[model samples]
Target chain A: MKIARHLIAAAALAAAASPAFADASTEAFVEDNANEVLESLNDPSLSRDERTALFSRYMDEFADIEAVSRFVIGKYANRFTPEEFERFQAAFKKYALAVYENELDAYRGNEVIVEGSTDRTPRDSIVDTKIPRADGQEMSVRWRVLKRNDGYQVVDVALNVNGNLIWLAIEQQAQFLSLLDRTNGSVDALINRIERMTRDVVAGRR
Target chain B: MLCFGVTDRPPYVDIYLFIEVLALKAGQAAHICCLQHTEVIMKTVVSALIALTTLTACATTQDTTDTASGVSDPFEGFNRNVYAFNEAVDKAAIEPVARGYRAVVPEPARDGVHNVLTNIRQPVVFANSMLQGNAQASADTFGRFLINSTIGVAGIFDVASTLGVTEHNEDFGQTLGVWGVEPGPFLVLPLLGPSNFRDTFGIATDRALDPLTWTEFESDPDLDDHIAVGRTVLGLIDTRARLIEPIETLRSQPEPYIALRRNYSSQREAAIRNGETEADPYQDLPDFDVYDEESAEGTGAGDQ
Candidate 1:
């Protein structure tokens, strides 16, 4: 039983630590969605409706919404009632949508090049990439879209200053959990603080 | 041996006191960031600082002999129970949902959906390695971030083979290894699933590196019906997906869970990071120049 707990933690550690793998993962989707993706990328100007449509579809297709949700819930997950948990998820999602919605908007004009992705082969797999900068020169900017059966999604990205964002996610999850544990056995307080920050930002108080 | 000196801290759990101190420092760093994922950076940087020193100091011949010759094989009895429980989870819950998903969404559609979501995660994944002090992995993560966010359309990593960059795995368990922590024993979490104290700590440590943890909090009302269930359900699916194949390669015993634990321990410790995979699809990606969108595009955009 004790060992059971240990291995569960191992599984969690494995699940938590390793980024989930995808197979034939890179090329199939890109090849299939080439036109839809190309259309989305080529049109620099998208109506708010179009962007929202893309965002919604993209969210369903690529966001790892579950992992993100689990992270948002934090340790309090063990403590929360189902209703409370639902509330927590709702709040988290709204915060994310509100945040990234604007972010996608900023990328409206820059057309993305659909660099082809390779399959999950043994020796070599391709990194399908292209720079999104409008002027398109000497900008330390590029996007790697790995494909799978569903479609394509971005794994790592350089958002201006911070280069390695995904690795940062791992670091953040590890650090935050410790703090939450050190605190009053709940991520409630942290969630409140995040909410406060989000409200302040939305209100232009940041 | 370096004991935690606190029985209350959990037994057989020998994370260096320096790490305990570093964990505290990491928490404090998170406290300071009050902005983004700097908390994770703080923990990774601090842990790396300690790991580099500790690994070197522990590199002496005698210490090396202990690690090389230690027969404890910490994971001896733990993996059996946990692997069984994880299997139970797959049989009961995950498979059905995945089967449903497969039926509802054609395979191509399923992959597309997964790709789109995975891309958004590029930023998060890139930062995860930096916390481990993996310079090259971090660089590749950065390159992946750029290519995914830009070319792949808002953060999905498709350009794997092109840039001669290969995905180097990292997680809490792996991080524990870098810090010279032993795997100790395997255990299954009640609803959560397989782990050890070290890996549990690694799990805890890895959280600090999660971008979503620092940025978006998931309290939205829309995801109510399926989003919430979908996440965990898909998580289990993903879990089953990754482990199922690997399991076949291992010698499965009557106690499958225990076997899994032992296998992971051997595989993780023995694996070393470095050496880019051959053939690069991203080789054609044009030269990159740094562009700080958060700063130039608008300050406090994220905060807003």
Candidate 2:
């Protein structure tokens, strides 16, 4: 009976401490990763090509490219066979790398300050951050981080768009799903579209 | 069993045997849960818009405190309720109609309609640009109107853009901001979305500046009324259609209210500053008209 009481007490204590731990760890994860990204961007020594490559490496390490690729397609993810899914995810990673290259370059010299964090679920957390501009203004950014067996992976980024709070993944879901819906749920169509977009970014057509 | 029919699912859903695979994964369940919480999520958006609108209405009357997002929203309670009302109306009526509009109208036709609508607003934009003494923007606005109106066939083709004249959005509110007038409290007017005290006055002035507000066609006075009402209705639908994805995506967020407030305020600030507020990653991307053909020409998968 004593052992049972001790076990219960231990379990209760662990549960009680879990959320605070999650918040702290999640905040730290974003701060470290974001600073790492900004460091590469702010590095005067690196050429544009070198910085972009470094940024791609950081995305590979910090972002769950596979999971995010899957998430963006939403329920239609099952439409792809293993080979097709692999193809799509690979193409998605390349597209994301290109998009983010342009994205991070805009913040080349800005500082990322992690404001705070909130645990939405036991495994899901959001880290709030701000990058103050040189002109006395600031931009708000939030990371939706999810915990996995390996470690934390960034699933989505939330930011303001025309006065609306939009999650990058969900926004992509809407866009991709709309295209898929129109193309009769063709994974190949999506893969091709993404590849063309990647080409455009690489070639500076957009 | 939350079984939304294939036709019934919102535009955000995949709509292709989605439910069959939905039960197979935890992630899918979470996405479904977000859809289930639509009304609750939208309440937050409503509150933010209302707060901004109320703030705008009372800018001269009340001493409003600035929120962390830099918006002064003094009447949050009243704003939230009004926002809720607006969201309910939007979901039940406006969005569905917009979706239907997207469905029946071909992409080119819709683009033409959007172009025409934008062209109609150029006179007002030009007025505000002149008010702010922005010579370049004024010239651009005037050139766009003159070119798009005649050569572009009543602004249906956006020939001005193709000619490299470009386009811009300027309003009396931004003119006030340029004059160093404060935004004064946030507000959310019912059915009009977000505003503030300065913007409310700006809205009124813009309305007065509109040629349609007072123009009486010598040929047909009744035609003028019809054109005015048609412009209002079509403009609302076009704007709503463009926003469905962004607003739907907003509902999936963890803190929609705060997100809306912060973002809305940030965007307004950016707009007031002529979009010189730090670099927006999503800015250079194409507009969120997913069904359009030329949308594929953009650099990224989505605007957001």
Question: How far is each candidate from the true structure, as Cα RMSD in Å?
Answer: 26.1, 19.1
True contacts kept of 1: 0.00
Q: How far off is residue A40 in model 1, in Å? A: 55
Q: What lDDT tens digits, residue by residue, belong to model 2 across residues B15-74? A: 111211211111111111122222332454455556555555654544334322356666
User: Which stretches of model 2 miss by more than 4 angstroms?
Assistant: A1-206, B1-66, B278-304
TM-scores for the candidates: 0.36, 0.49
Complex DockQ, candidate 1: 0.01
